[model samples]
Target: MIIRSALTRSLIPEFLTGAGRNQREIASALSSSRREFLRNTAGLVLGSTLSGASPFLRGESVRKKRKVIVVTFGGGARDQETFAPEGQENIPHLLNELVPQSSFFTHVSNQGILGHYVATASLTTGVYETLNNFSAVAPEHPTVFEYFRKDLKRPASDAWVVAPSNGFNRIGESECRSYGPGTGATVILPKHLLAAATSGGAADFDHLLRDNYENPLYTPQLGGGEFELQQLDGILRLSVADFMAHARTLSSPDELSIYIAKRLMQQEAPSLLWITMHDIDVAHSGAYSLYIEGIRRTDRLCTELWNAVQANPEYAGNTTLFILPDFGRDSDYDAGGNGFQHHRTGDVASRTTWMMALGAGVREGVIFNDPMQSIDLVPSLGAIMGFSPAQSQGKPIKDLL
Candidate 1:
């Protein structure tokens, strides 16, 4: 199914180019309700234009393979809370700092399942994935990780996924018939490791036995933690004391993930690393203050992640960073739900999101008024890293390619 709606393509450019009246004026004209109008227009445009059709190669040759980092603004966020003119106060670092150096896509559409795990699976695979959102199962198609590592013959240490979503343990690999686990990305669920380390959790021992003892009659259901640990037997793990000593001052699963990510950068510095931030999903609690706090904190964490990249010699001059929310939230006045509680509305607001691409091989300060899909990320990443996933249905982003 096509993920981008025609309204997304037709109106966002008009909003940015001032072809119509000002954004608020145009939004007013589109929907009688201000809330519904802002929801549709917020992520679509910011006026800055693409330099030309061949922007990527205006004055240079194809760039060398570069380090790539994709940060999924994994829970839902909305224009009222993020990129809208009034909403700009919440994301100072992004607007004041990163937007100036990044090629920002004001409108990004996610046309598939809105659940976090499945949406992320679609993002990494570039295919519309049909999978149980709450289940710990992997996608049915090959992921960018498999394509990059298998084709480049990169070592296991060269591709990584660090996430806090316990349900996302299987995101590192896919159940594709070919090029499967042998080339899956190395994944680190920081919270699980920390819990394992601190509690002497037998989750690990149980998973180890489960994988070895499986048979048709005796097979049992496993959660993401167990499912992930079973596949990661060879990776060295830290002792409770060791992890505590290393992270005595850190708290929250989000901070722990960031800590491990920086540590990974300091040591192995993988060529491709995708970090999923889940704190923003706290909105499920229905607390507006906590929800806003999550957005503010995510902004800070993203800045920290980018700063880590700039400081690391391995990632420093040659790395590219891509950031986007997995999807957006329902409108406050929408009939289905209220106040960012869920992403099931199927409204224009829920499927519409934004993206930012910065660092090496990106056009600085260009806010393209293009409406693109979440699946487009994989091919754009492939362009930078030098290999295309055989099953990706989306095309490479035009401006980036």
Candidate 2:
């Protein structure tokens, strides 16, 4: 049976009455609550924030050895289950380990479609891409992977995306003429990889292969150039038997994705790596307990990924790690919604999210309450990696660069 969380725990119940107010107003209030929560619990300092300036004036040598790993919560969890006091118990690692050594952004909003694919696509392209969320089409603009590789002259293996679902297969590249197919990142779909590796005996590993939480029947046709089963053995050096054997020990798809991603780090050490975590999105099933479990798992997995970066020679002391949700869940403020179970309503609780940046030049224990949009990510990445996002509309988050 699906257990439901109390309304008061989701968002400030009093604030729900102001649902008709301007969106910016609600977003500001949401940010303020998170700002205060972090200030009191995480003990983060409210210091420098986003300046929107390019990194042209900064030292260029720093970009040469820099490695970036992005962890995006594609199935956004609300504050009640994450950063708030009621939710703090679910994210002990984030509060105790990660947040203390990071620059946290309290007010990151997603002003695009609430669908995970489109919102994440908008983040990758930094253009608020209008492509259908459920469609197999690529982003209309150049992806950050393209900008990084085309401008920095990096090889295909130097940029990679370990996505959670098969629908994200095209996210590695875009249709832009300036930077087409060959210049983008190499996409790795962990579920698809597992499916291919265990074609006939899928039932035993069904728990690890659950795709698209919201639409279970809608598996979009995966594109070409994805990480193949043959490449898994040749590149990751894990035989099908070994991969399947180890996968049987895992609990969720996110764990499998991290397993593949960590293998990529050890084997390839991609300069630009992106990992999309969607296990938290299982809330669509209306199980509050499962949603919270996903949050706890994500919290621990995040620490695991960061620890891997520190332990690896290529990423140690030179990598910058970013963790943020692609968007957030709905609250009682949206009448058309089911609260924490879905993001159908693009209300403040659904659109407003947060981010944390750690390692390399990041300011330790700093918190920024300034408002920023999801689209700002690509341009910020371009600025950090010494690339020009010619078509990206969002500005570079200077605080991070």
Candidate 3:
């Protein structure tokens, strides 16, 4: 099966160019002193490696690697609005319905900057970000992607990150190169790219932006060269066609990501995958009812993903799916309210989160009450993938085993 969907390819140029330039500018700005420059350069290199670096570079064999799917419930959400008993009505499908069938954690907290990207970084790196606001600096510590790809020597293509929020575009690439060699981590956002590729006049947007490269239309300018654009065009053509065709069968964007993910599993069969669904967080758009609808849609998407995994041989019995939010939002009764507003100021309810795991080798009907942190996921996933955690602060949640 050809894994290079037109949409995936078409977006590559834009994705790579944009991401590469961001790193380059960040590196140059911080390059005044050699020591600090090297540090920043290391971050840039690691980030690129995470984007598309291959695992063979690290001397690791790739055969029959266990498959993992991590779903991020991004944009802080309160427990009361989700799994918590009081807010159960708000998320009927998830809280009241999707109970602790597999290993489930109720008191999961993220002690970090309480913002979306910061919490997300902490979740994967197991280290808190000092600044709560937007961070340009990558995590100093290695991420789960690095450990799995380098330490385990898995294929770089075997890992992926798909987030709806453009804010997480730098996730895998940030701490990617700490492993020293051979890592196959590829972060992608099919929905974003698809929307950009299929939207009316996107080509015009690209053309106009190219017309004035010096004064780029967006915050980050695209770089590389014509070769990049050609390669990107080819990729986008294929990805767009596939996505448009798939849209007929899938109604929601979450479903589209899942469909693409399954396609990736069947074709590339990556050992680890991260998929984020963001409509719920669109609550910031000031549409509480729409946010709730997004939650319901997410619930349906989860069920569909579960069903798809069971039916697909690549994932079936060999895969484990861990689902949780990047961070929780404030309670409706609290300062920000739950519908569709900001989550950065740090509300007690926003820190509350939960996790669910299901699949082979995982205990079923297990409920964990102990206080757990998002950082713990990395170590637990590492252990599950048959590797020892290296200098990881997070502990493995033994109950899952």
Candidate 4:
């Protein structure tokens, strides 16, 4: 249903009929596969059924109290393990509950480093940041947090991030001129908090304390700007003993993150909240069963977060929730890649992914296959929330606005 330009339409058939598969051909084929799978399995309507953009988009008065929650897939997941016929059984919540209420985009591509930290940094900044994936350096461009805070004249408490690693400490802010410290979101590392709360008695909690599944040899220094141990009592209103006692009941780090995010909603209720789920990154351990387990756990945790949004009066009716992966894992077709183990191959499968947007100001049960990039997220958010991403290399998507 994509209306290609005359020249592009003519060129596509030649590439499709060509002997070797090009990047565009691979991406288009993957998108078409996902589109057909969701349509048949989830009973979603094609976006072509809609007339134009969504009608729920309102004015600044309504947007003043609007909330946005972004959940990212830190580890790569492939179609065969997620949306395909063989993998559909693993994500029952997304297929049966969420996708029917979401505007699904099947052709989102990431044109940046495939590492979790750097890729997520690009997602926040709307720029392809080249900083070391394992380092503690901040992004070179301004983040969406800074724009949302500075332009909207909101305070630090209004924007917050709950990420999975020490590498994300600087992700809440950027070192860009005129938009640096104090003008961004405050990051909360749940594993780091648990480590401090247990105070060297964390041997029983090593499974929940796993950090940066991609690399265990390098631990970055704890940067000072993030949420610290002392503030846990003052901010989240939970004492160290109670927090650790609750942590004893959780199975994964993403669950702990969800627990913290729910408290944040009930306590501070920030207007902008970003949570990165890293459990799926356990694939780097080369255990296929564990990787599948991570996916199922993430699926349940995502629904829990959405339910929390609906249960809270401050966020229930006005919040827009977006769920997508930072990128995808390698394909079994690639000879150089080990299927689903790691994202180091950076193949076409690794670059192509999907996104779902649902809630206020969004169309439901429609699938759009229009090609987009990970960087476009910031501009789309800016347009919806009434801010300007001055240096972003992407444009706002009109379908949501």
| Candidates' C-alpha lDDT | 0.69, 0.86, 0.55, 0.87
Residue-level lDDT for 147 in candidate 1: 91
TM-score (C-alpha) between model 3 and the true structure? 0.70
Model 2 earns a TM-score of 0.94
Order of the predicted models by TM-score, top scorer first = 4, 2, 1, 3
Backbone clash pairs for candidate 4 read none
lDDT of 4 by residue, 20-40 (tens): 888988888878878877787
Candidate 3 segments exceeding 4 Å error: 1-65, 84-100, 131-137, 175-184, 199-239, 245-253, 335-340
TM-score of each predicted structure versus truth: 0.79, 0.94, 0.70, 0.94
Cα error of candidate 2 at position 27, Å: 0.6
Candidate 1 local distance difference test against the native = 0.69
Q: Candidate 2: where is the Cα deviation over 4 Å?
A: 1-11, 48-58
* Position 357, candidate 3: lDDT: 79
Q: How far does residue 192 in candidate 3 sit from its true spot (Å)? A: 4.2
The predicted structure with the larger lDDT, 1 or 4, is 4
Q: How do the residues 1-401 of candidate 3 rate in per-residue lDDT, one tens digit apiece?
A: 11223322222123223433553332222122211211221221211122232221112222243678888864545442444233334554443334434556655667777666667777777777553334334555666787777766666666776655434555664434455223435555554455455563243233111211111232322221111212223433345555555555654556656766666666667778888776666567667676676676777677677777888877787778888988766544444444236575454445656687777655554455556677888888876676665756888875554
Candidates in order: C-alpha RMSD to true structure: 8.6, 3.9, 16.5, 5.1
lDDT of 4: 0.87
lDDT accuracy of residue 246 in candidate 3: 56
Clashes of each: 1, 0, 24, 0
